[model samples]
Target: MKKFLTLLLAVLMIASMASCAGGEGGKFELGLVTDLGTIDDKSFNQGAWEGLVQYATEKNVSHKYYQPTEQSDDAYLTGIDLAVKGGAKVIVTPGYLFEVPIFIAQDKYPDVNFILIDGEPHNADYSTYSTSANAVGILYAEDQAGFLAGYAAVKDGYRSLGFVGGMAVPAVVRYGYGFIQGAEYAGGELGLAAGDLDIKYHYTGGFAATPEAQALAASWYNDGTEVIFACGGAVGNSVMAAAEQAGAKVIGVDVDQSSESATVITSAMKGLKASVYSVITDYYAGSFPGGRTLVFEAKNNGVGLPMDSSQFRSFSQSDYDAVYAKLAGGEIPRMTELDEKGSPSVVPVEISTVTEVA
Candidate 1:
């Protein structure tokens, strides 16, 4: 504990000195602290950063980002502390992993405002979840986005599907469950029985690219799974690599990942860039919804598929519009973490099985 505290103190002190310098232009008033990935991972971190950059560049506000040295609660907290010390007025944290750290930081730096995307603040034990007056939590309707992906796949004639998630966090779970729901919905449209569609599900335990994840994806492809929804940050890269090797297709997550690889047929996209830009705008306009958790879903145009960039042969723009209308208009009921019993029962048990690959 002593050694850890000493290291933390050193980090904070260095950050303080940097803040004091203020560079030639001035201190960076806007800050972003990344989770376990770089800003250009073409997923979570990048999406959020793009929004910040767009807003900051237009407003001529100084902005910077700090990456943690490790992937633990302490390491994450350290990153926040550094941002605060470095004169960050408003800090944006882009994933659920920030829940605990932002929980602690909200109290530690009461004057600094925070925009927490994809999660709300909560203690480690989760017995308490509270966003202070200085912080605002932003959540996306991932289920809706995932639903679009699954519905499109089945409508376009793919029966065998696989879902590879980075972790079983609430966001990822919502995505997986929505995908299953969509597949079932489409299967019914095609007059197929409950046992007609097949889906394989698993979580990679973390949001990084790994040999194990790639190998597992390759194995699933080899076993006849038609397309895999790579829903875990850099883990998607691993799945995409596997798809390239096996000549299979992929459904990406978080943002428009179609550009990342030709194997990516589409992406279940949340408005990461637009939402961040909007929140920052609100902050500057004195209307930031502090101390509250905000939900961005289809009703508000917060989530959908990138139709213009999606490579679908039969799932035309008209097909997308029909399904998306149902989702956005509440005609389609969404299944989230709350709707699960033990786990999201990939509905119609006879047609589906969740393997939870090791």
Candidate 2:
């Protein structure tokens, strides 16, 4: 009888330890790695993090996140491995910064599932790193969202605008190109003359939050550009600051920044939260969108203008309704794929030639 009691106690202790180590009664654990930033940058990283948080809360699952201290590749992998070692069944990487590390992690821990946002790990030979079959990639139709914002800017009577970009990547260029197209389309539809509104563009070549963005934006504001569109990760915050200080309007990116950038006009938002939330929920259901590259467009509610209170509080209901109808009716075309290798493709909506500067 004493021997039986001892075995039973041992079993109970083991079960308790497992439960304590894992989140939510031993249910599958989820984890996220941010890209050289925190989880609350009010931007891309934040949007992805929010989605996971909401899903975990709703599903009563276990999850955690770790931001890198040194903000290097080694630091990123260490944070990711920390979660994996802690028994995370599914790990999420927030940005393209993790392209290389995720590729390595997938091979190192074949049993773990990975969700990579905004990037895929591929070698020069077009061969993906030897990764498990459990990894998935999530991308957005950012060009389309940028198009909508540009169209709305013109419709709202802001012709001369400025574009501030974080990096000269595909995503940033997509937003830039789409905005130009939307403005051109609006000018034609509104019967406005060409060259009525001039657009000045600049790229900071970095994603970190910096005062340099504000300084760049200030120069444009001084040059009479009344509205600005900023797409840098942390650099965007500086743009918003300049807009607020100069009493000019700004457009935000990734998530809705109307609330975060309250002094700004609106944001060209990707449904990052929804995408993140969907991945986590799928994992719980054993139907994660693994081994696939998921592309979300405006048609999928994956991209749109901001409706957050900070953005729309002062906007009349009719203004919101009008802009929304235009987007929904396909009168607005958001650019998705651009042919330009490192820059945004310039389709002449108005000007025949466009010069890119960084």
The number of the candidate with the highest TM-score is: 1
Task: List runs of model 1 lying over 4 Å from the truth.
Answer: 1-25, 338-342, 346-358
What is the C-alpha lDDT profile of model 1 across 5-92, one tens digit per residue?
Answer: 9999999999988765655235778999998779997778999999999999999998999999999999998988878777899999
User: What is residue 166's positional error in candidate 1, in angstroms?
Assistant: 1.7
- Which residue pairs in candidate 1 collide? none
lDDT against true structure, model 2: 0.76
The 10-residue segment with the lowest total lDDT in model 2: 308-317
Task: Give the per-residue lDDT digits (tens) of candidate 2, residues 17-49.
Answer: 887566443433878878866888777778888
Locate the minimum summed-lDDT window of 10 residues in model 1. 339-348
Candidate 2 clashing pairs? 144-334
Candidate lDDT scores, in order, read 0.88, 0.76
Q: How well does candidate 2 match the true structure in TM-score terms?
A: 0.82
Top-scoring candidate (lDDT): 1
